[model samples]
Target: MSSAAKRKLYLLKLSPEGNASLLGILQHPDGTVLKQLQPPPRGPREQEFYNKVYDSDCCDRILLELREYLPKYFGVWSPPTAPNDTYLKLEDVTRKFNKPCIMDVKIGQKSYDPYASAEKIQQQVSKYPLMEEIGFLVLGMRVYHVSSDSYETQNQHYGRSLTKETVKDGISKFFHSGYCLRKDVVAASIQKVEKILEWFEGQTQLNFYASSLLFVYEGSCQATTMRLSDVTLAEKRRVPKGLLSGGDVLEYNNNIHVINSTENGKIEASVGKGLSKFYALHKKSCSKRHHSQLSLKVENSEQDNVWKSSTCITQEHLNGNVLPQLEKVFYHMPAEPKESAKVEVRMIDFAHVFPSNTKDEGYIYGLKNLITVLQNILDN
Candidate 1:
């Protein structure tokens, strides 16, 4: 069936709540989600990046090494109904990573564009002196703006604004308190980031950088994965709108696997019941004939061997199995018994990447800030 026609059928069968909660509108037979975005300047750029950078044989050595930190790229789709819109079919990270609670954030200054105008250039130079020294700052870190999956909406609940501090705070909270990542994983992730920066600096033909980052937390088996709640760092007022085609629209998808909402006054006691109810509802709703068949294939992304890779730093070389210093106070006491636990932080949103003329100052600035933020989260 045509994509547009499918959407009309979805609207008729799904309830108001179900429609709002739906995150996947065009699930490929292979299980990848098809995201369609309007003709923004960044849309075509993003489509090009996926086609030529990740999937193409541009920089296989470096990109393959850093693949763990990126979303898997399938191909592109151009629906006849929306000629102006660009559709990118990508491996749904949530499904690929086993429905982990995800968080999105922009690392650098959003308003200050170094190359836009003279005033902006001066402002950036004065604002990011340290970034100039680092030699690797991205142009403008825009998570919500470029991604079709992330809708354009004002954040209200978390903080009615989006800024550097808000983004950092959101990231810090997720790493320090929200989920308990192993000390080795944390150290390895930092090393990977540093290596990626070095690779970018060495590149001659193509300069790669990310405006936004995504953190996916694969909670323990016992932990409930709330598939409809990955909130933006700014705590978006409403979930970011997903792919929209005619009457059919895919809602945002997020999994709140770590912390369950408070209920009947006792938060801890309510978790079990809430999980039961969620799963029960999911099974019942999915059993309906109208629903699209959910697809979950065994993912072989670079992350599968991230910990086992010999090139990166090993766990034994770092601190022992005990949690890092920050974990003692911030992390939950007696951390949840996670079976096959995995946590990853990867840079995403490459639509705005442009060749740097004024040295790698902007790119360096963003990278240094991100590394520092991540390190601080790990150490203290």
Candidate 2:
């Protein structure tokens, strides 16, 4: 099997307080840098110094806003630091809130049993007042080995041996099945566990669906493994077909149908392209009345300009060019209508590269414009 066929998985769990800490880091001026800093000393003096430096009024405001914005399913906990690196008990936070707050944990292994581990975790966390229950979310990635037999079978099925189309189809099917399984089973399980955690957090009075929107990553190694297992089971259940006399005629007929369909698709694509070009060429020659009618038709046929603009900005990054730069400026402008109140700006490619100072500046400007536009939209 190729190295690409191997799989790996990782799982993460976060309590409400842990999440708040993370959000605090994200919102801070030097958030990215601060994450690399070690926890403060465990002594009272150290704690006081750390608080003086990092815990400003702005931090309190952000924390309050976060409490309101964040989902309530997770629990929160806190403990003061000591100089010796020993921390205080979470009981303090629990006492202040007049409720239980569970600790957040993350654990994973390549061949780990998630269910058994989750059960163990639930047992361990039960010692806390508000943490009698716990939940686990799992994420994984896996690579499947396309055996020589399956490759030959796929090639025969398409009447061409392992072509680009066959490989594309196989990979697409693999990813689709993996994604679906994660959403249906793993995500549902996470929600179930979170509900158990919430119940322990003194949210017993509130009613919630078992499958509420608990966060779950769609792509992971574990999801891939589960998907592969399912696929293997399905393959095992398949009955092999027996060759019969006079099969040549049937095979020929199927080949002809396939060839015809391929030809038809090519013809359709060519025709569509030709028509698009023709329309574009003649569109400018129309009379004012015709142009007005065309404009109305176009307007009705396509999404509104605002939506188009928003989508376009999201698809591309700002490069200090006129269009994106203008968008960045305009995003800071306040607008009317609550829906348009928030500006959506896209500048940095978060996935591909680390954001530079210039990109950060662009993002800030874009956010400013977005807020301004939203304000205008709301006022009008």
Candidate 3:
């Protein structure tokens, strides 16, 4: 993560004060965070997850301790008159790590709909060949939007091609300020994810249909860890296999774009001179565009040009200083250092997760593929 002062703090929780769903950070005058969630209008997904899945009789009997693998669930919140307006509040896992860089990956295929109409399923299936040709698809990236800004601004910035953006928008903000996952942390995260999958095997009465894993990474050195979140998409199947009509198969979508990997590569390749060089390049490009747009008398959108065009470290220090210092720090480091990366991989986003009366092959196959991808990343 960049220096605390320069980092654009990302807040994903919705405040109890606001009726509308919001995705931005909220802080006290002294800088203390007040993270909370506001439920969606139509979905009882998260509520169902906590009531039926996490707190179920089946989970109590077979599942291991939840805290070891998951974040602490605080309980549900509801408004006075509106039964529909209910929110699920859980521990803000990002706060557990210093300078967290969070990433949310929606598991399964984009076109996948287990309950979709037959025609829709066929259409989605037909597109699989073309989708396979594309390496991995990133469904979404957690981004920082100003409090007064609408979702469109953030979405527009994120939707833009990564390499094409030059402004201090969402992508730039994340790369410039977010935590970068080091190799050790990545390995730890993979191992923890596998362990959780193994735990899933024990709950034969429950079939976990997960759609996403929100990975939260923290730390600057080899001493780091990743926290998983957002289990609203997971659920227990109606019945276990064998006695069931068909088994469940975990669908694997090869299109994955992890923020750590993407940003790390950019930093190593283009910003080796450190963040200052990248900032310099970005500022130069932005200034030129801004000046040209100024003469047109067009509306100067705040979202486009509002970010501070600066970095924590100077170019001289970044180029002539940092790496050698890090090398010296790790000179006598063990393969897995004593206080090495500590990753907490908890499966999240259980909204789409439900009981499947099918074989478990789909779910297992998808999970193994994900593990393989993580392993390959470490190997490379």
Candidate 4:
């Protein structure tokens, strides 16, 4: 059956938070959503990028490899009544979550594409002067507060108010369940971003400008908890003196774990209800052992703050790896427990992609900063 005949006949109320389109995005019952094709250059540019990446016959290695990091794309859909209205059908990444917390972050130091005019560059720089240093910007986010049984939406204006110091805190708020914080999700998300970073490090075919990363995770506080009478940190590394008790270091098993930031007093009370743990390992020097592996150790890239392979390791990178394996094995990853707090991060908005000869240093710089911010959040 045609996708239009499936379930996207009506307007969608739950489109993403920071949509800049004249019409909202649409969702079909077939586990896909529709984004209306904008006019002229922008629409054609996005479609071109998607088609090249999605094309099966096109043997371009980078585009083919990038397919996994993006939403699965179907062909364009045009309503019979409104023939001019075209929409791109894409995988609905949040469909599986009961209450998904979503955030959109735009990456890179430059928002304008290579084809952009001087005036456009001036406008973008004036809007956010720190983009060159930060390399990323938070556009919008929606978080589900389990305590209130409601979701609060924050728009781009709130994102614009953030400073470099407060950006981590703002990002931290997305994981706050009101009752506890979800660092497990943070760790998993970092791994995924690292994978994307690894891809950017080796590729020279295209440069992604103004591209954004979309993050979605289950926000319902009814976190899968089967009263674990006992829990322990992996490898039994002793945490600092007072960090675990009340300093927000949670050291439970790796499945969907959260922490009480203010007090551990309720821990005894909450244990019966089931409480999981979260631990972020930070090593000040390279002499540390028994550390987790992070893929930020690309040999070819010029990234600093390197974090893997006889160097800066944390707890575990989960399914992350530093070496580039065979294509088939690289994409096939071990699965986490179904009950574990799940997170989905995919690259979106490819309208500004440009063919280049070398690695995207701007994007890589932004990603490194992003991972550092998340690391700080995890450690603190």
Best-fitting candidate, scored by TM-score: 4
Q: After superposition, how far is residue 52 of candidate 3 from its true place, in Å?
A: 2.3
Q: What Cα-based lDDT does every candidate model obtain?
A: 0.40, 0.20, 0.36, 0.61
Provide backbone clash counts, one per model.
7, 37, 32, 2
Give candidate 4 misplaced runs (Cα > 4 Å).
Answer: 1-23, 223-339
Model 3 lDDT per residue over 1-380, tens place: 22222222232322233121223223222223222343442146545655654563544644444345655555654334444433455554554443344454334434354665688667755644322222222333332111111111122123223321222132233322212214555666677778766765555544443345556554322211111222211122122211112322211111111111133232011112222222223223333211111011112225474221111222232233433222111111124622565444555555555555553444455556556666655565
Residue 95 displacement (Å), model 4 = 0.8
- lDDT by residue for model 2 over 1-380, one digit each (tens)? 22221111111122322220121111111111111122432134323323332334545432233233122211111212212222211111111111111111211111122233676555534422121111211111111211100100011112112232232233222222211211222223233333333322432221111111112222211101012122432232221121111121111000001001133232011122222332232223222111110000001122443311111111112222223112221111112322321111111101111212222222222223322322333233
Estimate, for each residue in 1-380, the C-alpha lDDT of model 1 and write its tens digit.
23211111010112323322222234444555555543665677677766665765666674465465666777676545444434577665555332243454444434234235687667655644433333323221111211122211111123222245554444443332111233443455566567656755655444333355555553221211111224321132221222111233322222122211233322111122222333233333223233122222121224363111101111221222322221111111122223233545566666666654343444555667778867876675
Q: Which ten residues in a row have the lowest lDDT in candidate 1?
A: 4-13
TM-score of model 4 (CA atoms): 0.66
Candidate number with the higher TM-score (2 or 4): 4
Compared with the true structure, model 1 gives a TM-score of: 0.47
Question: Could you tell which candidate, 2 or 4, scores higher by lDDT?
Answer: 4
Per-candidate TM equals 0.47, 0.16, 0.50, 0.66
Clashes by residue pair, model 1:
136-363, 136-364, 137-362, 137-363, 137-364, 138-362, 138-363
